[model samples]
Target: MATSPTTTGPRAPAGPGKDDRLTPRGKLALSLLCAAQFIIALDFSILNVALPVLGDDLHMRQADLQWAVTAFALPSGGFLLLFGRIADLFGRRRLFIAGLVLFTLASVLATAAWGLAPFLIARALQGLGAAAVVPTGMSLLTTTFPEGPQRNKALAVSGTILSLGYTVGMLLGGVMTDQLGWRSTMALLAAAGGIVAIAAPALLTDSRPTERPKLDIPGAVTVTGGLLCVIYALSTAADQGFGGLDVIATLVVGVLLLAAFVVVELRVAQPLVSLQMLRRPTVAFGNLGGLTTFSMMSSVIFLLTLYLQDVLGLSAFETSLVFAVQGAVLVGTGTAASRIVAALGARTTLVAGLTVQSVFTAALLFLSGDDDVWLAVTALALASVGHMSAVVSYGINATSGLPDNAQGLATGLVTSAQQLGITIGIPVLSAFAASRVGSLERAGEDARTALLGGTRTGVGVDAALVLVSVLLIGFGLRRADRR
Candidate 1:
């Protein structure tokens, strides 16, 4: 075979063009990709709700139950950049289809799991599959749609669908877990994954790059390993104190490995992530903004889940309904983000989004068990809208004006930041809540009040982080920086 390896851009028949209208084929392709996003959203929600049931069935201890969530999270977050760059080297469509097959198969295994180990293995496989799909899908979107109205519209549809999927999943997960049993949740993912996997081949085409850069094995190992260690450390700290030997050891290892990754990137010719790319204002600021928004979103969900179910004495389904409000608002705002970006430019839109999120997150500080839980619901709704706005805007702003070759890496950075944010947010913010729990208990407060104090403390921390992102936007969101 000839070695005219190509970077995976769009292999769309229309190619990049002047007009933004999609052919019928394009719409079908977009729908398939968007469906994958929906599956991911649904998968996330269903698993969380089903964990208790799984733990009981498998006879696993409560301590080990976190693995159900962590197993999926670890590889998904850690291997993103690796698979993303691989998508460029091999082929986005090829990797994507392969990933989907793995996801679907893993879902089957998970549903049929007879033991804890098998289920954990299945979750890991599914996470690896997600690692491949998320970045590749975004990369394909950027390539398939011509920038301007076409790309903007496609992204809008994707963002809206993404939020809608989360809401739908939360509601569906509860219903499925309650009525049909937790097994139904895994079955649902398999069905969704199978449908998308089947459509993928017929709808999407792969672009092969001209030159296949040598894989940066060192860079890949160090970075992926580093991220894994980091997330593990935070998780350990959440359960065991941060001062524990395991937590400190993992933190040191993670930092050292990440530093080594930096060194390897500088030395290697075909680095996993380009050093130059890191310096771009859009890349740096965009990823930061994405991380901030996503972490807070995850953190808020973690805090609220405990508060709503435990403190407010709400059912799992009712808690899901409250969160459904946020997800619903995100769908609307996500749909409208394109016009907002058009009018204000991506930078301005991003700043506006960050600001909106800050305001709403801060408002949650006032919430208490005495106050109506609607206060939390309303704040989260507004915050979700703002979060989606920031998500879409930051995506456009980051990927804009990039050479085709770099789009894969760009998307990887965005996706990795998102996963990393979510992974860290829950553990770190949960630790914050846990930290306050002991203190409040010692103060002679009732269990509900103490738990309430801890949850609010976590919410306050999320609010502060959002404000920090606003400061970053102020400094970085400018016309000159977009380049």
Candidate 2:
């Protein structure tokens, strides 16, 4: 177990009875942390709207376009544990600030990129920065706020910011890409990262590590390579088919490598992830639940964006607006979710949220080209509300049971699971959609008509995925209850 350095020289008299909210300094620090979080969240969804523009400008094929997204997702997904451990071992504030610098530099480079290779490299760099931000931000928040209501409130606010950033990113990316061009969006991201970098040193207090852990180099390499291989295998399967020898071999190797990583962690003196933490009911259930939900959510967003643009004849701006409605619902619900969690225990909230999301997603099956736009938007908003509620509840549960120093590692693990889910889910869903479309086309549908059918099939698959996610959550909750 590890502990953070407590504020040793604190002698300020108690302010009133109990309503001792954040001090002025504490409020500023929270603001800076939220800003960093917003940047990371915004980066995740911002590129979706810009992808087409970037593809056209850079003369990239669809396969290459996927790389632009994967380049960011894969590294960010895989390196979280490694970076989170670094934050805990060295210093949270140090790694946080360093990550900001690296992220900002990457954004600047990406903004200036003229070719696929440079842009992909820059995106990978940005992902590395994001890998640090998620865990470190949570660690800082947990340490800053005392336990009970105040900490819950802070967590709620952080969750809201995370959801809000995704919404704002879609709208902002659309506007930037339409007016200023795709490159300008990256430049704006750089500017935001720079601001965070400058504010970090001033607002964040340094805390020395309680226990310095040795770097698990072999574990890091094994896990990272395994994750990348798995993601690559799934991604390639979308285009090349799962029957390809390359896909099979890559997936096999990835699974073996990941198994090796687990074995290594169990034997290591200072493990990258503390396996003991996974034994906690709340931590384990929350992580698995979060992973399932996020996986379905990411695939839904990807498929829906495609459906909105290709089948519904929506411009990128219009598509972004549609997602914006969902985003707004996510923000509003996420901000209030902690109260809900307090009222209903985490297990109940998790189950309820997952159930609601499942229903909302299933409602999409009723949609068609002739359906009312407002009705579709309503369903999306409902789904968003349920989704954010689930996320915030799970997030609070995942971090609450852990010790302060372990917060980073726990957060990282949860985040890594979610990313891994997305990496695996996307290609599987895409392949299913392709298969459905092919079946329809073989039944005499025209090429254009078949493509439109494919979009609808993709949405259906997304709905099915959400249902499966519901089951996963329910199973995890049941397991927790039994324990």
Candidate 3:
């Protein structure tokens, strides 16, 4: 077995009781790390509102519109584990800065593109950049702050910014696209990425394992290809339905590749992912909680956006304003998340936070097609408190008890759950909604009414799934706690 070092490079000075307080330099480092996280989150949603305008400008086919998202989602989600292990073997800070530079350059290309092909190429490059950044950045954060209150506090801030970035992107995307044109959205990302890239080397410390293990080429290839296939298939199934030959074939290939990955990992000398690390109750259930929170919330947001715009006849800007309230609530909740985790423990906090989100999401079932904007706003805001808490606690829970050398791999899994949540949520719920809407339309319902019915079904199912997660994680973690 490869041994980890006692300390993760040079960190802030901390004695017996002073471990929680960060020095000024430590604070600066945390800020820069969180900024990287914020930009990644921002990139995910910022281009969404601008896609239609971009399509018009680039003369993109209606079918090609979704590529803008999938292009980014594929590489970013697929390559996380590979880059994460690479960071552990090489250096986290080096990869982090490199990723930011790539992301910034990709954003510049996106801004300059006159057609769809170049723009998608830029988006894929951006995703590849993000794949390097997310896990390495997270591992840096964990390694910087020792596990406990200090780590929890840092995660609270990072998690808060992560969620806020997505919501802010929604608001800014509409405003920027309307006022300055669609290119401004990409320009904003470029500016943010450039600034972060410039600041990272000065603010962050580089760390790698004492012994460099050979990179797991077979495991890496299988897993990365599997995830790309799965994500691409899921995204396609959302638009074209699961019955298509392409979607079915892609999904089967993904599954087979994933199975091959598992077989390779079991036999390999140094696996890309350590199966032993995944068996820890905290690691397993914590990731499950993280995936559920992100996926359900994302699906809920997708349903709400459709409800606000298509069903309620609100403009894109108005729809964003509704989401903005949830963003504000998240800011406050994130600030308090550390205290909650300290008092209740990570497991309890995870269960409680997820339960709260589920309760509020269930309230969305009350929304009708006519006039329920306030209800949507209220449910969104209230649910954000739980969302923020879960996001904060799950990170704490997942990374807790792991060794310093494993930080990169552990954080990789945590971040991968997050990316997968975003990749999977919308498609699963959208497919259900599309089916429900088609059925309602066939039953003689009007377009608006059918849409509302579909959204309601998606929201209700989302709420129930969350409840199921509560039981599974709550009990699963409890058993682990007792042991």
Q: Which candidate is the best by TM-score?
A: 3
**Which ten-residue region of model 3 has the weakest summed lDDT?**
1-10
Q: Which stretches of candidate 3 lie over 4 Å from their true place?
A: 1-8, 15-19
Query: Residue 4 lDDT in model 3?
Result: 41
- Report the C-alpha lDDT of model 2 over 31-89, residue by residue, as the tens digit: 88888888987887787778888999888997778888788887887787888778777
10 residues in a row with least lDDT, candidate 2? 6-15
Q: Which candidate, 1 or 3, would have the higher lDDT against the true structure?
A: 3
Superposed Cα RMSD, model 3 = 1.9
lDDT of 1 at 471: 88
- Per lDDT, the best of the predicted structures is 3
When sorted by lDDT, best at the front, the candidate numbers are 3, 1, 2
**Cα lDDT listed for each candidate:** 0.83, 0.76, 0.90
Clash totals in order? 6, 0, 0
lDDT of 1 by residue, 266-319 (tens): 999889989888887888898898888877887888788888888889988788
lDDT of 2 at 140: 75
Q: Report per-prediction Cα RMSD to one decimal.
A: 3.0, 3.0, 1.9
